[model samples]
Target: MKIQQITKEVSIKRSVDSGTEEQRKTVQQIIRTVREQGDQALFDYTKQFDQVELTSLKVTQEEIDQAYENMKQEHIDIIKEAAANIRKFHEKQLRETWLYADQHGSVLGQKMTPLDSVGVYVPGGTAAYPSSVLMNVMPAKVAGVKRIAMVSPPGKTTSLPDGVLVAANEAGVKEIWKVGGSQAVAALAYGTETIRPVDKIVGPGNIYVALAKREVFGDIDIDMIAGPSEITILADETAIPRELAADLLSQAEHDMRASSVLVTTSQNIAEQTAIEVERQLADLPRYEIAKQSIENYGAIYVADNLFQALDVVNQLAPEHLEVMTKNPFEIVKHIRHAGAIFLGRYSSEPVGDYFAGPNHVLPTNGTARFSSPLSVDDFMKKSSIIAYSEEALQRNYEKIAAFARLEGLEAHARAVEARFK
Candidate 1:
């Protein structure tokens, strides 16, 4: 880890991978093939990429039940509890269709409607992401989305991880597909013979998945193109060095591109944290990945004071921020940007990642400066409702016509005039 004096120019922003031209071309071809061949394309891609020949694209209820049998009862209970917390949190974000009448005898407002269907892509490679399933699907379920389809790349056994299956079941997702990568994204964006198209697609994936989402964006709504994981810790003299190091590494282990930064007012704390990060890297299960992440992207900044430290934090606008100051609450008010704030020592980043009510799917790569975490709103669409009474139209029709005429839209002007006539 590198230690440096905090400056206004300090930045942790990494260039987002837009995929090489070859990869983009590959993704485009895959999407085109899926559109043409449908289920045959999905099955063929699954065989080529995942090395699994599947008779069917969807996961059966029997497989889901067997997934339960494979997992211990205690693990199942934990997944259920986590799902409950996620659902409870997202349910609060649900809004009802609303309208208001004005003095002009016009009813105007917005109607909130959940999407008819949604697709959630859970990546499968070296590890299982049951948490991803819960975070992405629960919000759509809370928004009253009728159908939530989940897709994950199957392993050699031709099935998803037990935990991923259990999480989907707990999250109330009935449609699970045993396919992933660019092909799965294509299947979601365009309907297959078996898998129907979804109105929106959400969840994280590899570069190919991201590219597929980008290609199909206008056709179907998609969650943001996520970047690598990031954690920026803002601490003071009262903060413990070891705890800060541990928290930083938690994100570093996620990916080689993941960034872990510490901004503090204490010079001693900065040096100690850098040392502790190196010390802790030796024991992490993903040791090489974390070590490389720290060496390349990790940093400890020494700030003159709390205000200066906060300035550095806001500039980074990290996806996950930990405030380990003496008074975390006071510091929070000053924090203008952060996807998720974990205050105090007890509120570790992983708490929000797994068990906490807040959605762990957050903005990364400094997007927190303008973007927000995934929420129920992402799964719902708003329709503007405008009802102008006869009296109101009589009063405003001329003004509306004149406005339309100014914009060179005579048809629009005539339509309002015809309404009045």
Candidate 2:
């Protein structure tokens, strides 16, 4: 089979998608008004964006109870298991600040503190991913966040997705609001009459939600401005065509603009994988979405060698990357960028997204080169503690004064000089 031609050159700008621009601008306006007018603005936007009218902005306990009553027991059990696994994985990542004392009475240490509260934004755009609820909320719980609040746009008449409420209940959420979209983000970032503002906001949503997060970043912390979903498979002759095909199809179902690429050294393996993809697409329920995603951004490149495939992956820095080859370990070390690296065929992207101990809330669109997967660290802050004894201060006061004087800051020099003067 002939390998497909690569793009003339990598789109360094990565094609800034403008399809959602109109919605994004509308959302921004909603966020601004929501920030100024509070619950009234939320009520208005909920009607406009979500096509719902609501009496209350917060989901009542009675409503949550009813939501639980309506859901099937089997689904509840599955959510329970997923939450437990997610909590277990994040628990291992929790860390404590440390302190050290020198020979003198000076103490040097960092005090780790959790944010007072964090807001989780779950999109109610057509579906509810309980997995996302667990992934976003569990980390804050593990980090010891004092208050965890969630917001999701309710259906027309302000009704939340059942699974979202159930997942929040399972994850120990303190409050759940009947709001979604950019307006909800505004309410979280800037406190409303009923909803208290939080120190950080996280979770995924559509482009409107993404841009809203970007705008409100400084007012309150945000995890990341997520891009479209992506996956890249690095394979050679030893890989299974069918399994590779399944992996590619998995990410393709996320959105039409999502990218899925296969970089392989062996022409034979590349040909087989392509055939495998077509065969599997026939049975996929989300075939149109998967097909469009693959056709628009998908590709199979014939690398000169296995090393060449590795180089390509490093450059792309895909959100989900899989290495399926004779020695996956040898390839893993050279991978400089990628949100999550799945080694060997058994370690599929779905595994990490669901049950794996590592967080599925990862950096996307080449941001992995500098950013990282959501972790306990994101919810915690460090404050340095420094204490110098009188003897130590006397020893170093002149030096400190001299250094401050060199910088031409009399106040700084005076502060140090006063200690010994």
Query: 1-421 in candidate 2: lDDT tens per residue?
Result: 1256444434322435543768777767878798789999988887886788898888888877887998999999888988898889889998888889887778889999999999998878777887888999999999999899898888753678788889899999969998887888889999899999999999998777788888888988999988878888999899998999899989989888788888888888899989999999888999999998887778888787776677788888888899999999988789999988999979998998877767888888888889899998999999999988888788888999899989998899999888757
> What does the lDDT read for residue 95 in candidate 2?
85
Q: After superposition, how far is residue 252 of candidate 2 from its true place, in Å?
A: 0.6
The global C-alpha lDDT for each of the candidates, from Candidate 1 onward, is 0.92, 0.85
Question: In candidate 1, how many clashes are counted?
Answer: 0
TM-score of each: 0.97, 0.94
Residue pairs whose backbone atoms clash in candidate 2: 52-157, 152-179, 153-180
